[model samples]
Target: MWPNPTIPLRIKLSGTPREIGLEHGRQLACQIRKQIEIYNTMFKETSKLDWPTVRDIANEYRVTIERLTPDIYAEIAGIANGAELDILDIVALNCRSEIALGLFSDGCSSLGWKFKDRTLLAQNWDWTASIKDNLVIMSISQQDKPAIHMVTEAGIIGKIGFNSSSVGTCLNAIRARPTDPKKLPVHVALRVCLNSTSAALAIAQLEALGSLASAQHILIADSEGPVGLELSPMGDVYLKPNDHGMICHTNHFIQNRFVDEPPWLSGSPIRLDRMRRLASALVADGETVTREALRKKIFSDTFNAPQSICCQEDPLRPLPTRSSTLFCIVMRFAPSTRPTAQIVWGKPGSGEGDVIIMP
Candidate 1:
């Protein structure tokens, strides 16, 4: 289960309050509660959640859901309303495999490479999913505000919609040297992206929102490509590509530029090495580029277990105390006809969805 279930939702406004409305604000709050309840019911079945209870939880966390501009909220709420199914439930099904594999990350970055045979490789890694049962599903749209749907053993807290103007929908974990609860939660960045429609807009939103905490790297991918944006609270931002046809990000920073700054303290390089090794093995096999092959590689227990993805202290030397997988996410964005297949393995042996197209 997640060490903490209380995720505070902090909304920062960039424009005037006149742009927002009361009805839209109430609707956004209602939708957030609905999505959270859907998650709690699906995963935390024993505990039934009511709208009031959900609001109470949000209030307890000091989450100001109303800070989002009304226009943005209306756009996002419209998408949530249009969804044929409960967005949270759909995400739960989409990530069933990772849930089964017990792979979770603080953040994740993936590259959707278009190869010669109309094939694509959706390579990704968990930054903090290793932390136990922290499962989060995030989405960002261009016109609407961004939202995050998070699920842990405790239950669900952040419930955002899917779709972004520029970056599409993405989620990542930002590694902080000294963990601080006061800083804006990483989910806020996700919300910003969800609210953005285009990459240019997303970038603008990031600049305006500013940083509440010191973050190491961000896991972002969309129809365009995947990017690992590393940042410091001081306003330094670095961009890296998932050039390896396949890229898996962990909590530790992986750029050579940042190597000189406390490599030992930032993140575990050894874990990165293991992921690289696995990627190499898969690429060598040639079949790793396929979505199915990538999934097999990601869920392989031969290299490690408990934490499906390894978290090592040192790549050169080995040490225990490493973290394991909490939830695994395999995102495949092929032609619309080719269903976006996601296999969630919440447990060992069997899983709950179809290999061809996630539930």
Candidate 2:
């Protein structure tokens, strides 16, 4: 079932990045606090580090984030002020993967399908189920940039969303040789992608971040077409749409040359293959893939139980250690005047979500 009707806190704020962050923090203070607790607990259980040391380490990530982009830094600072938390704690939450030191990675499915003049960009972000109620969708209007509608976990600056510029990004985790402590974290890099107006620009930004942006598959799409990157702080790989005119990326690297590192997420290989077949069947060649049709495939659970595409918490694992499909999102940019993104909270096919319009 959907986590709860009260979930997916939606806020629309237009102003400077800092101002937007402050309003975001003030409105979602409860969730921000709860999410912080959850993240700290996960860090403790997974890594031997305590929350205090995590904060100190978060300072380095702060530098990375700041050096990467000043606007994002101000936004984080504003969130810290509005939420009444340390800037480093918020930074730590954003850099959770780096904090884990490459021990954990999440699963997701991102696909792009075209029909006529429309493009469908969709993803299912699978993570810890505990944050189902802590999820949020923030509509941000910043100076000199396109308005953004972001569907993400509390305190995450970016994830799956489309900008008013018709640019959309979907993220998937891939194992790298271990994160370089000096580079930008995945969450921070995602913010850079959302700020971009085109896939080529995002690729340039990712390249600029260098090896720090590594160990992930990032799919950047616009009304024209889409581009995929298997980024590593060491180097980056470029992925193009296959002959089927579709791109389906799971947690593992699909590019033969880039699949050297093993995946941190279990069942990644199976999920990738399953999603490809499903995408082929759901979106035929040269047919306009409607939002409804894509949504149905996104929420499919042919495997069901613990291993299904729409994952559920495994009874065999302890409560805090399990991960599930937290949310599913479909971002349609060309069907309407502005970008419209719909989400599926908690389990798939529940059909409960809010329509986010960025005008």
Candidate 3:
């Protein structure tokens, strides 16, 4: 039997109408319930969810209900929050491995007139394994209105996808600097991205968020062939050329402006080193030039010991002492292909599932 199977669900919503009314709220709540049922069924798990049940889950997670306005949005947000709890419960039941690390990411667009317009993409990998797989869902309406975008995988709700509005995003552990718990969790940032519809809008959101957690590097890619390299604390942003046909980002900042600290301090030195080695190997093998070659290189673990691409609970250090977990994720955007290409490390059943397509 599979050690543990986590379900991943990704959705894309567009052309949704935004209006506030009791009927609208009821419809939104029904949609949220459907999403929850889909997530639970996907993982063969059970979830105790209702409008009120979901609301309580959101409250327990400390998620803000203000953004989930329009009554329907609020109900949907509550369901999304409850989905997160279902994922946690599943992990507690089936996770046989010690110290399973989970990761979450979000990319948001068009929030509050562009004050915080940047998409928020984050990695939440530490003590618990993030939702079964990297799952992201989003909803976008006409400009100047609230939309509902909910993401859940293996019963966990958050953000994890790249679609027409925005690109899927992930983070590489570059620095192991201590962070404050009071600040917003990285998962919240991923949710922010799921809420966005464009790269420009996502960037604006990041800028408006200001500084919450410690300094870290964010890698964002949009369906429009835009790849962004941004830094927190300093709030520096850089853009890469998508004209080259394809773009691939691992853990580490490509920009010189971003400093590279010791992995001991960054908690990803070895993983970063491994990613560098993989990149170098790919270049040596002449795979760096092609998108397929790059994907092959990312999955290669020639070193054997201390598997370069595998996720580690404690990478040469304890959790409390380490900055973040070392997990591997490769986001590839190839519009030339019939459908968008997305491959995540953990999905369901297979442990490593096939590439998921978003249309």
Candidate 4:
């Protein structure tokens, strides 16, 4: 029998942070373990760090995380208990960005476009295909916080997601470093942003914590509009949409040139330019850009093969290092209705995948 292409596991949880997390842990235990093994090997191969060293680094952030965001910390503790894994292990998974310090060649393309009536945020999550099965879509509800629906690695709590408040976020990993243990880990920061009621509030929360632990580009959007926040330990820069009301970002820092962006993905520039041109073509003459238009014109483009906007694995590379577009998510946010995410399990334009909508 053939395996299903739409492989992401979906689950819903409500109540206290711990309860929500415990359900996440217990239900996705198999995928969580697989995620650990994948990350363990990836850490050693990409950053020359062993699992023990990674856990040690993750341990350093525990106190700071607990003090800064106790609710998320409690959730992490619950996930640990439910998964029957050490809290340090779960912490390491959540803090993978800080621990690795942008050492890996993870590439993604994100854009936020404002239509006349509604706004859209979309991205192609490109990374090693080894953990494809570890992805999950989580619908979480808490007492005071906005409800969240996000797609994340099984063991991670935060990632690309939108909340009940019409605020959505997309991430792009930058290959620049000097991570700070005192700050919130990248994933933790993502969760915090999803918990906020608005994009501005999310930015304020991250700024209050002194920015994220490492270098990253988080494209945050709400009913009003979108803002591209280039966060780093050195400083932070925000990129507003162009006059065309389009914001595009790949894996490099655009405004902050002081921070060195290694040549991890040489195709990044090519992909970025491609998106602008494609977007312009789609919206020329004030044409309204819709989700289907984006799906056909942008995310589906296979311009520079293997490294194009629609990334594909290079067979010449080893299985562990090869990367591809694991999933593509298109989110719609409007003032009058609830937020929703339309996700494709595989490459978007490939004509070979299934769509899953988030509630």
- The candidate that wins on lDDT is 4
Please give, for residues 65-141, the per-residue lDDT of candidate 1 as tens digits. Answer: 22432343343333334343333332232222222112222333333443433323232333222223233332211
Number of the top TM-score candidate: 4
Q: Give the local distance difference test score of model 4.
A: 0.89
Q: What's the lDDT for all of these models? A: 0.38, 0.74, 0.36, 0.89
Candidates 2 and 4 compared by TM-score, better number: 4
What's model 1's TM-score?
A: 0.53
Global Cα RMSD, each model: 11.0, 2.8, 10.5, 1.5
Q: Write the per-residue lDDT of candidate 3 for residues 41-156, one digit (tens) a residue.
A: 32222233333443343342243223322322343333434443332332221111111111111111100000012222222232223323233333334344334333333322
TM-score of 3: 0.51
Name the regions of candidate 3 deviating beyond 4 angstroms.
1-77, 80-158, 173-185, 223-230, 233-267, 280-285, 288-292, 302-304, 312-339, 344-359
User: Which ranges of candidate 1 are over 4 A from the true structure?
Assistant: 1-175, 178-184, 256-268, 301-326, 334-341, 345-359
lDDT of 2 by residue, 1-359 (tens): 33365366677877998998898788877888988888777877778778898998888889878887889889989888889988987888888877776655466778876555767788778777777778877778889987888887777787778888778888887765656757878887777888888767877887776645347777878877677777766667777777766777877776635335764666777777787877777655544466666767655564644655777667886566677777777776664457677676655665455443333
- Which run of 10 residues does model 3 get worst, by summed lDDT? 106-115
Question: Which candidate, 1 or 2, has the higher TM-score?
Answer: 2
| lDDT tens digits, residue span 67-162, model 4 | 899999999999999999999999999998888878777789999998778999999999898778788788898899999999999879999989
TM-score of each: 0.53, 0.91, 0.51, 0.97
Residue 70 CA error for candidate 1 (Å)?
6.9
Better of 1 and 2 by lDDT: 2
